[model samples]
Target: MSDERTAVRERAEAVLRRLAGDGARLRDDQWRAIEALVVDKRRVLCVQRTGWGKSAVYFVATALLRAGEPGGGTRSATEESAATGPAGAGPTVIVSPLLALMRNQVEAAARAGIRARTINSANLDEWDAITAEIHDGAVDVLLISPERLNNPEFRDTILPRLAATTGLLVVDEAHCVSDWGHDFRPDYRRLRTFLANLPAGTPVLATTATANARVTADVAEQLSTDASGRLGEDALVLRGPLDRESLRLAVLDLPNPTHRLGWLADHLDGLPGSGIIYTLTVAAAIETAEFLTARGYAVASYTGQAEDADRRAAEQDLLDNKIKALVATSALGMGFDKPDLGFVVHLGAPPSPIAYYQQVGRAGRAVEHADVLLLPGAEDEAIWRYFASLAFPPEDQVRRVLDALDPDRPMSTQALEPIVDLRRARLELMLKVLDVDGAVRRVRGGWVATGQPWVYDEARLRRVAEARTAEQRAMREYAATSTCRMRFLRECLDDPEATDCGRCDRCAGPWFEADVPAQALDAAGAFLGRPGVPVPVKKLWPTGLEAVGVPLKGRIPPAEQTLPGRAVGRLSDLGWGDRLRALLGPDAPDAEVPAELVGAVVEVLKDWAHGAEPWPRRPVGVVAVASRRRPRLVRSLAERIAAVGRLPLLGAVVPVGEEAAGGAWGNSAQRVRGLHGTLEIPSELAATVAELDGPVLLVDDLVDSGWTMAMAGRLLRQSGAPDVLPLALAVAG
Candidate 1:
């Protein structure tokens, strides 16, 4: 073995020994993976799901790197290390999403003989003391949430400590950083900005059990690293089981909101090992908790509204298995790593399949039998639509908030209060709406609207529908796939694949037998380019002109007539033809044009015209916009296409740029300078992109204005590139 390999194995064995003590052992796979992560300079994007001992990767990697001769195999720590600290420091600051998860990690480190401390809302002086300890070389890991990290005091002290420290940086529940992730948080957005300002050579390792293709891209972008090989060579994705072989999947559709809590209360009375009942609202969460408690179930409610202590107690109760069930809003769980959850019941319809899968993922983590139940009714659809609608605000409303907050200026809610017309509470809700829209960032004490504002319109309906469709298709595909659920999940996750576990809910069944394709077709209506068989003329007349070459002037039916002033009139006065003419608008001269009546008047037109169906209501076409940043602009243009014209917005044309020093190059300054270089899509065009599933037209204002367009084109080609049809309003050829 190379000296580096020997060094890594030695470090892994040492960490194992420290944790288990005498005679401790490391699995060959665990030892090998940990060794690769430690020696490799590329930051790690670990894709293992929950309960797969993911934290071990970090602990083992840290030990390996620390054990090796400091400068030879590893990059030297930034000036921020002890060399930069007050002489004897070895602290590694962990910017996390939650206080509870931080505590859990701290406890785990303690079990391994590592000294770790946390600083959140509950403790301020402790944070200062921990830094002193870190500066004094007594601290090992310092855990903190993004909210706390946002404090100028925290960043001032901690970032400098981090800059000088040589240890590792870890982000758990990494999906929160992805725009595509359902549980996106504005606080998470600040993580990138913070990381960007960190010292050079600081390696980051992000972990998430649930991440889709889009989420993975966003995560890698945020970490400011190329995603090429972070997961590992021969890295087999390890997913436990989809089938809870012993558990069952049940769905309930209630007629009204009142029926849901009552139903949950009666069913969850005797469940054990802790259960989580998720609702769409805080009110529902509280009501459900109250109802369950009234029925003698040791239930507690958890939401963003709960006091820190109360929330912590509730979480601890669930962890200790003291609480039979915890009722909470969808916001309650993200970094939750509980492994023995017995039941995960959705008291309402989750907005998308990704959400449903993620929530259900909380269950069956202990490798034991567990159930994921869904309760959906007619009312549930409206309720979910209401919640989902909040994710996309009306364009005017969005513009109001955007105009109020300036990017060049330091932004906060106070600066926005005067210009914002909504009531104080309503304003908060609108901000939350923008939060889900990925248009703003929520900071420690205020809000920052990070995205460029665009007008919202009917096009949003398409974006929402497209997003919903994609998520539903993904979920249904996973649930009903014929292959191993683990393998399918790996594919769905867009990560490396391991051996098929052959034990998911779908694998154990006699094939899923789902009619997803058929359902999708029905939803989309008739095919875009095909015409039906011809019909009888008796059905054609009401609208007027028959076939194109049927000699309309001579043997003209009562429905046909060529006017003297170059205007055409329908003989039978069918209102449908008039509507068609109106839709075409005043721009095109009205001829005895039978082209517009293709679909609706198909019964009449089909009789005369032979071969080929008329193009459907909306033809799918490609529209590409040239951009240095694909993620930021592509989505916006796609939304636009889907909106103005009813075209479906397929995906994006990400032109792969050149590989450079520790990062991918040429996409955008945002991609290069910002931690996650997220491409911000205009909200107005989001719907257009969602509706189409074909080629993306490359869009931009000018090609020669700069190299951004060409560079974006190159990068798009590299990233499994979609077809790049360049479309610009103006180009300086």
Candidate 2:
């Protein structure tokens, strides 16, 4: 046994040397994991810190498994029988979470003389060829996104064959398998089915750096389950200390967004090397990147909304150290590899320490030292609440979705949007959960019911929500803790060997400057205070609107469409965002428009009047969309705009029934249906609009779905206004 172990270790080291360097060696835990996978053919769960070479273990194990050596004749009787299968018969299938991670793994595999291929949304056209290579036994590693596991074609045809022949199955970023994890994904739950289908004696490995004790146990349980859906007795778990010695952790409490922005601008260059600046929202990322660029910094904004090509370009620029930093959101997190990333700065605190650790782990991986700073804003809790609102819907919503799905025919998500109240993202998530539960199935065209009853599992969902709340509370405590910051994060992740690192702010005192330069502060304030985001015109009606009793479909008539408009700011903006949230939040009491906001509105109108693409003609009249919740605020905004622009105050478009009172909370089709016949021009207003000489300024307190603006503007145009221009105080992102 000892000699066999030595042989296995030698082979692993050789592979590691190729992947790393001539001097590379496997750590004790890495060797143990490789031994369990390649020699014992056992399932293993590895929870180690970043830069711990978890990937190295799997790559080496893949090499050893395909070579059919099994530690040079150390195989047991059962393994010897299983050896009847052809050598190098199958590729190692790695279910990864992000495209960036897949790319990194593919490149790393090549270093070990392994041929790797990926099939993701980005490489759809190449999937057929790649699958052929895998069948031909020419591919050593196959990386796929978690979402691809449920692809109708892949799941129905390709996955079963791969499961039967796969040499080793690896689940990277395995923490996502647990709903209790900070970044839980519903699609990851599909792995259970895949696991149940794998052939006997096939090795499996799950790797992650972010799971806490609860999440770790959850993931381990899933990994241990056998093909019969029963838990197995033996599964190896290798957990290591979570401390990152090279990281210098600190938290700077800024008074507001202005101070945080100013601090970044003044001190970004002083940070060790090129790195990432994380913002909580897309709007904030864009705003921060623009400000930094105007200040002569080489930076770019990266968000989920960015085009794939743009995201790739930004990532490459950052990797090459061509850009000072990439101002990004959580979209850039998870499996992004930059061994020498010098620093990571957060503009706002994440909802939990586990998530924060996962992101900061990107830095200090290869370097001797790296800086990690958190600038916790006062609005962090509000942002947390906003995200929490998108969590699993109530039982009624789930039932509605299931009821809408047909057993005999599939329904595309777009077709169901009019019938369901959930947003597209949340709805898709619900469908995935249901699919995993056997209540639904994704087909070639869309999704169909399975005629399987599914319990809501309310208790489990409640526990998950409670866990999220606790995580948020823990994050708040972390921001205020005077104890060792690194130790605190480790403990938050339930690291068994957590201890003070003696390098964080609380351990050795402040390592970052607290004060923002006066000039930078002024510049940041001015940049944030600068207003006006374009309100894009909706050119096409939402699909399947007729299903909701609205005849609208295809492109909206040009004459009925509102001109491109402007908003004073986005509700997700860094400057006026908090104030707008306060004024427009459900709990807030409505009142007349504040004078300062009116001034901001005037500034927006000024820019719109003379800016490059000015309104086709000066507005001759102003009209407000009647608001049941904020009538005073909406009317006052319209009145103020008319007074400033010297236009007549045309009466408001009135809502007719309770349907119109259904606030802007549903999908586009539902919103349009609610406002279709409900909003009409009052007789007096219609007469006034008929006499308008030029475009009418349509004013509202907020634009959420933009359906209200479109429907109201359509009504005005039908009533004889020559053109309609929308102006809103805030636009919801």
Candidate 3:
């Protein structure tokens, strides 16, 4: 090697040893990536397995770059900028995707003697100070979320400076940049613009352990661009075999969530160390955590819904071995680094094998042996379908968003919601997609049309959709395959060198019991069976409803609103979700309430009768919402409640037209319009309701928007019932 290359190599070694423990060293690929970044000054895409030290390459590169080239003397930050004619005037910038990932990265950076700061939604109060620190060159690494990249203040003013001044730009979890990526984020595409503005030869590095060959090529193409927006021919791609030998992989196809939870409860104590219990939904996470806690396991739920403080506390607890597990959703997926993590048990399969690989990669990082089990639930596909709906918007939705935007004036997402009836999250995602497509631009106020004619790539979207379907099928096949599960996943990732992992269950016989203990099963059944999630009364109307020509604005009057209600269970609940989903699923034949559901509601009302905040008054009568889809189901539930409580069953509140009844779509104001003065009591029903002396029960098959129950209850009250209560078989999540 040349003397200059040798010196750079020695410095990289020193940095790596510090970041890792004593006697630690880099693999050849790791050294190659560092060489490319610091010495060759080439953009590199590293696709290696977890625990392969992707972060080390960037941190060592940052140290080497910040310390100046191996030469006569280290240059000052400004002097280096002047000499190089570009690159960071300050620190390296990392576009992290998750809060948990950022926290872990910050700590890891600190151990390597690199001063790191994060600018994220959680630390808004500290952003100005952080910005100042970066400006003063006091920070070595700045980790910001992808969502933060598009912030008005950050994007318009601060990002260019940060981009131009960055010593090394790292896109961690780089798969998120590719639409074909399993966890694609629209915000990450903003890096295209961010990249275009960076100083030439800034040495960008994109790293991920999960990207397949296709995603690697896609992200590499993205990373190949320089500040001048010129795409290069080569992007120093470092792809490796993604096989974790330490993970003893297996799949447990339980009959349902109950059996899975029971198996977890029965076997958790047998697991070697503290680890994560993955769930499909937040409700499942919370439910699993609660059930495990009841079984004497020290566990907590970690999901997007968790408060930042609580999530931090939970993470620390697991790190400290203070908790046995954290039942979590994908919120805990990428960038969680725990070297000694001993196990990962998924309560349900992720949408795809690659996604499963990414999550299971969290375990067996530094251990000689770690158990990785996938508990494939019956409801896994349903959950997957629900999540798959959040992909890049269809052409019509995209066009709707663009049509709502005016190039002259920015419109906040809130203001555009009524104009275009998309939900907030979907709307934001659509806007981001449109922004990338050049149809609209997000500015200081909000988004504005760019007047750029954009074609909807229907073929491309169909390909993405098809790819997702293929992934789902692969996951199912993985569960059923007798071959090495690790090999199956590696092959799913399109690894050319995929081979049988001899340590996996298929290769070495089953490692876990197929049978859950009777005691554990009973316990799980009891926990799952005990149902009823409180349905908080909707009090306020959606904002901007009046400006959209709605008759009213602000809060709904107490007299018109129904009181806090009860549903047998949420459609997302692990225990009750399946039952509720079946009962309310589209094309589900509507009839009388099932006996089991009736029994569950009886228990709900029984528990309500004994609770501290019991019903304010005994229901004098029961009223069913006029149901076109499930008239029998609504009537049966009401009649059962009335018979059990010895209350009168007043006739249904029948509204005439579907236009007035409203389909299950639209925003709050539109729903109110559909329901407003639209519900009325027939003369016969009105006479019966008039004689009621107390609150009446309003029954429905489900409470999706809660508008049906709210309006129907108000009409019953107007008919002479003193107050109204809503009772639904299921509450849509």
Candidate 4:
């Protein structure tokens, strides 16, 4: 047995050398994890910091397991004989979280002479070939996204075979498997089903760098459970200290958004090396990237909204140090491995310290020194609340979804959106949760009711919500804490070995500049102050509108369509965002337009008049969309614009009944249904519009679904207006 163990160690060392270059040897913890997976065939959960060789452990284990080496004393004689057979062991199935991570893992696997393949959303065409490779024993490692586990075809067909034959299973970014985790993903819970179906004695590994004690234990418990709904013996958990000695952490409390932007622009060149600048919103990321580029910096904006090709190019640009920074959002948070990432600067603090740590861990992995700075914004809490609102819906909403689903017929999400009150993204997320709970099943077409009894775990969900609130509170404390920032983050992760790194701002004194150059500040202000976000016309009506008692389908008639509209700014913009949020927030009091906003509106109109896509004709009149919530604001805005433009003040379009009272919520179909036939052209307004020789300007406080504007525009065009131009104070994302 000792000789066999020695031989396994030697093979692991050789694999490490191939993966990490010559003279590379495994750390004791890395070797222990590899041994457990390759020799002992026991489950292991490794909670080590980023760049701590977590991938090395898995890749090395894959090489050994595929090579058909002898098993340890734990293996029975029959099992040992099976293990010693020719090298035809099943490939390692790694359930990774991100495409970027999978790409890195595949590259790393090749260095160890292990063939790796990926099946993700990006490569749908290649899944068949990859699966065939797995079946043919021509692949050593197969990476898949957790979301794929719930994919109907993959779940119904490929997953069962993979579970039965997988030699080893790895769950990367395993913290997402825990509801208590900062980055909880509903699809990750699907792994529980996969784990239960795995053949017994299949070694499993779950690795993450950000799991707290609660998350770590939760993941381990799930990973060790058996098929009979029974918890097995505890899995081997190896959690190392969370602290990164190479990181120097600090927080800069700038007075306002302009200053934050200015400071970044002024100091970006001084940051150690090519790195990432994180923003809370896509609008902010784009705005910052544009501002920096105008300032002569080589930077690119990266967001979930970016094209996949653009994101890939931006990532490669950063990897090759071709750009100074990639201004990004949480989309770039996990799975991006740049060993020498010099710094990570957060334009706004993430809602949890664990999430913040996970993002910052991307830096200082292979470098001697890396700077991590947090620029906490006053608007951060509002952004946090916006994201928190996306959590699992209340019990009533969940039941409404279940009630809408059919037992036999699978319904696509688009088909269900009109019947359900949730937005498409939120609705899909709820469906995933339901699918994981066995209340629904994703099939060929969409989702079908399982007819299986399921109870809403309200208490558990409430606890999770409370946990999120607590994390937000902790995040605030982290920003305000005078103690070592690194230590605070480590403690937030429940790292038992957390200590003052004696290098953070609190410990070593401030290492970053707080001053912003006046020139840079002015430039930031100018960039942000520039207004006029295009309110894209709803060219096509949402599908299945006819199912909701509406007769709409396919393309909206161009004759009845509103010309592309304009908003003074986006609600997510860094400059006007705060003021707009205050003015347009649900709880905000209805009032007349403020003078500053009036000035900005005038500027937008001026820019629109001469802009490339200028309106064909100036408005002949101004009409307001009647607002139940902000009547005063909407009426005042329309009257002011009419008075300023010297155009006739047309009366408002009035809501005929309670149907129009439906607030801006839910999917497009729901919004259009609630608005259809509910808005009436007042007799006086219709007469005025009929006499108009040019387009009528339709005014509102905000544009959310754009359905209201579309519906109102249709009404105006039918009432004899040549064209209807929609304008609003803000455009909600």
Candidate 5:
């Protein structure tokens, strides 16, 4: 090799030694990636396996491009170029997805003598200081969350400088940039703008362990451009075989959720070093962790809903081997660096093989062998379908958002929510899509329509939807396939060099027993069978309700409210939740309460009666809400509760509205208005309530937004009942 090339290789070795250790060295592929970025100044896309040292390539490249020598340090702060800002200092800007991942990246970068700093939602207090430090060239690397790229303040004020000066731009977990990716985020597409605005010749590198061939191509197309504004084919694709030899994969088809929980409880002790217990939902993660902890396993729950401090604690506990595992959702997916993690167990299959690969990739990174088991459940598809439904809304829904937005005034998401009838999350997602398409702009106050001619990319969206459907089918096949599980995953990801390792259950036969101990099974059953989830009463009115001409705002009056309610189960609960979902989901017909659920409700009421703060008096009467969807179910439940408790059954609350109230759509305030004046107490029921000396139980089959219960209870109270206690069989969260 030429001296120039030899020197570059020597520099890469020195940098790797600083980041890793004196013994650390780069593989041929790793060196090639660094050469492309640091020497050739070319944009590169690396689609290697999880433990292929992807991060090392970027860190090594950053050291080479900025320092210009092996282990060379930074120049004095006074020498920093004021005209070009921090890019003059040649700092690497990494766009990361998860806060946990960013934290890991910062620490990893620090080990290599790389001066790394991060600006994310979790560290707002540090952003100004970090940004100033970047301006002064004190920071060598700056890490940012993808969502920050689109922030009005950041994009308007800070991004232009960072983009212009960024010496090397890195898109970590690059799969998210592609809509074809399993965990697509609309904000990630905003990276195109960041990429477009960079100064000419800024080297770029995108890295991901989870991209399928399609995702790789999609992300590549986005990264094809350099700082000079030239855009064409993928910069350079270096995809390698995706199979991990250290992972001994398997799938166990448990009979039910109870059995799955039981098997986990019985077998968890046998797993090696601390790892992750992946769950399909946050509630499931918490439930699983709670059960495991109760069963004497050392574990903690980590979900997006957790506070940053708690997530950090849980991550640290796992890293320190202080806990056996962290039961988590996809929130814990990317950028976690645990090399000796011993096992990875999934309570349910992810929606796609690509997503599954990304998550299971967390284990066996530094181990000779690690167990990767997928406990597939019947509910996996349901969860998949639920997430699929959140994709970009139909054209009509998009147009409604456009029409609601006046060019002159910006509308906050909360104000648009009650008007457009979309939930908060879906509304925000729609707004993000609109913002990207140039139909609207997000400003300091809210979103404003740009009046741009925006066409719904129907064909593209349909294709995406169809792709999700196909992926779900593939996931099911993965569970049922008798072929090598690793080969099935690789094939699903469209990896050309797929091969069977003969280390999986399908290839080598079952490595784990499918049996659960009797005691464990009983405990799992009892744990899941135990039920009672409180449905808190609605308190504050949704913001901007008056824009829709509803006068109500702030807190609801006590006299017009339902008491803090109780439900036998949440639709998302692992225990009785599955049964409740079947009974209350969109297609279920109005019917009497099931006998089994009737017993569960009785138990819930009995527990309430014997609790520390039991009802002031036994219910004197029962009142059912007139239902458009499940009248029979509501009436039957009320009758059962009244019969079992030996209370009088009063007439149901009648709906006097122009149309039936309550729906799957709409925000809290809109829901409140729809049923605000609709529910009425009949004169006969009024007289009966007036005579009652105790509170009445207002019954419903399901409590979704809680508006109907509040409205119905208000009518009972107005009709002279002393108090109203709301009860329901299921609460849809």
Candidate 6:
């Protein structure tokens, strides 16, 4: 190593030794990796295990790179560091996961007189100000959360300036970038975008205590590293022993929910020092906390439902040892780096091993000996199965949404919804989620489906949102298992030691496994029969499509049983003719279901038609129209029909109210056959048969309500054949 590299390395080593005590040792490989890192231009993934001094690698690298001219003499260990100047000349920006870690680092740096600042959700504006100072050469080092960095405004307005003057980018808790890691953020994918915008030759250093090969590859790809072969030596991957000898992993099988709670109470009573209890829901967290607190333990609970400040304070209280134990949902311990924790107890089983490992790993951080306890019960398993059923969306729905938009012209969400079957509100949210995952983009007002909207391919993105839901379900299964909770978790995480968590419940004690129970899989099997035939839930009971003793008579309308032709007849009888003539004017028959709704429906339909299971709970809408031929009032109505061509359906019109006078069309039923078809007419002429569109729905009240629908339908028909279904809430007498 060069003299300057050695000096930088020595300073970093001294800091580590002082912090970790004299007995701490740095691996030879770690040192060599640091040397290579100091001189490299490419980004690096320092994939080391816990207690391997991964963070030190970046600090040393940062010091060396910022030191002017590689061979410069070493300054006194206590010399005041100089402030950065201009773009491409500033201190390193370390992007981390937790605010607590940032505050701790900031405090440590302050004591040494080194300027450091932390930026997270709580202090975004302040972070912006510190970022400004970096641009102006006023700060030496800055620490921030990935969420803050992911903000586009921050990227656009603040990052470019620091990038111009920055020395290095340090990503702590880097395991989150990997699928194998316990936690993943959809926004982490943007780190690639951030790196691309930074000054060339600026080194990127990632530090995480946990990662396997796949995770390493994920990190490599995220950092935009060239993984054509394998990781570079400069990458510095220090793999420590996976075995946590001092932390005993144990599992307990509870016959029921009652036993599970009792088990938690028992464990909390005996445990000493700071501990954490992870549960599945907000209620569980609160209940468990109450139980422990009532039993005389100083306990606190946390969940997403808690206010932001409350959550932060609760976390700090845990760290400050104000509470001896914390009963919390998994939301409580992301990127928490405190090492003094004595135990981690799962009131119920964790869903996956990755999660279990992450939670259990918290206990032994500051001390050598720690313990993790798992109590699995029946309710946990039910929750898991319930959640797993939400994995995928109906295929037809996916296809419809995709087809609604032009590949060239990205339509606004509002414009697209009516054309598809999806409810206006829900489809918009899914689009937003997809946009965050990079599968789509928001341009103007609508989401433009970009790249592959891969309804089937879940592995395309590094931070796949699908896996998150899956992991969540798996967590419930893990928590509910009577088997070795650790073993089940390992299986979920795909850990090689799947059945070998030696000290777990399965390994140490008698096991009682619950047999698989019967339940209907809604998204699976052929419950709908064949296409074009609507099977209401009540009708599907004979097929054994029952869940919880009764078929859920979902939102499907009772009129769903009427044949298409009958539905059309009923609408026509309701005087929709005048309405159609008034609404369509010259083009009543052409309007298709809003273009977006068709796409949405088609997307759902295609997914269902295909094998994609577990459709997400999305809102869908269908509109039907009914009308009679009214030549006297609107002449070009025929021309409108010719322009729009055929609609999806048409049935004999039935008349109601004053429009009922026209019973003549019913006689020629053979000519047009469709049911509950939309009837277009005017409300004022309820007693008259002034005009109509054939194969109509008698929308008596709607006909009187006015010409809006009929006019729109006319315009729709005038354009071309539309899938415009019709709708009428009531048929007035």
C-alpha lDDT of residue 421 in model 5:
66
Question: What are the per-residue Cα lDDT tens digits for candidate 3 across 240-288?
Answer: 9998988999887789878888989999999989899999888889889
Candidate 3 vs. true structure, TM-score: 0.95
lDDT of 5 by residue, 501-546 (tens): 7999988999799999999999999999987878787767788877
- Which segments of model 2 are wrong by more than 4 Å? 73-86, 659-665
Compared with the true structure, what per-residue lDDT tens digits does model 6 show for residues 1-733? 6666666567556644544557765677567666655555556666544545665565545545554444445555443142221222458788877665676666555543346777677875576577667666566678877766545466667767766666778888787766456566545655655666677567677876555566766776667643243333344444434555456666555554444554455455556578888886565676567655765678888886788788778878988999987787777555665678888877655555665676677777667677777766544553454333333334565567676655557676545543443443445544544555566765544557676645534454324444555666666655556676555644443445445656655566643232212221121111211121111121111111121132322342333222111111111111121232233333444343233222323333344335334223211221233344443222232222322333222222332333322121111111111111233333322212223232222111133212223333332333231222333322111
Error of 5 at 314 (Å): 0.8
What TM-score would each prediction reach against the true structure? 0.56, 0.97, 0.95, 0.97, 0.95, 0.59
Q: For model 2, how does the per-residue alpha-carbon lDDT over 78-150 read when each residue is reduced to its tens digit?
A: 4432312356537889999988788888888888877889999998899899989888877888999999999
lDDT of 3 at 287: 88
Q: Over all chains combined, what TM-score does candidate 6 have?
A: 0.59
Error of 4 at 26 (Å): 1.1
Q: After superposition, how far is residue 720 of candidate 5 from its true place, in Å?
A: 3.8
What local distance difference test score does each model get? Answer: 0.52, 0.88, 0.84, 0.89, 0.85, 0.51
Q: Report the lDDT tens digits of candidate 1 across residue range 112-193.
A: 6566787787787576677777667766677778666456566565765565564667777777776577666555665655
Model 4 Cα lDDT, one tens digit per residue, 553-624: 999888889999999998888999989999999889889999999999988888878888899899988999
CA error at residue 683 for candidate 4, angstroms = 1.7
Q: How many backbone overlaps does candidate 3 show?
A: 2
Q: After superposition, how far is residue 174 of candidate 4 from its true place, in Å?
A: 0.4
**Residues forming the 10-long window of minimal summed lDDT in candidate 3:** 80-89
lDDT, residue 548, candidate 2: 72
Candidate 1 displacement at residue 390 in angstroms: 3.1
TM-score, cand. 2? 0.97
Q: Predict model 6's lDDT versus the native.
A: 0.51
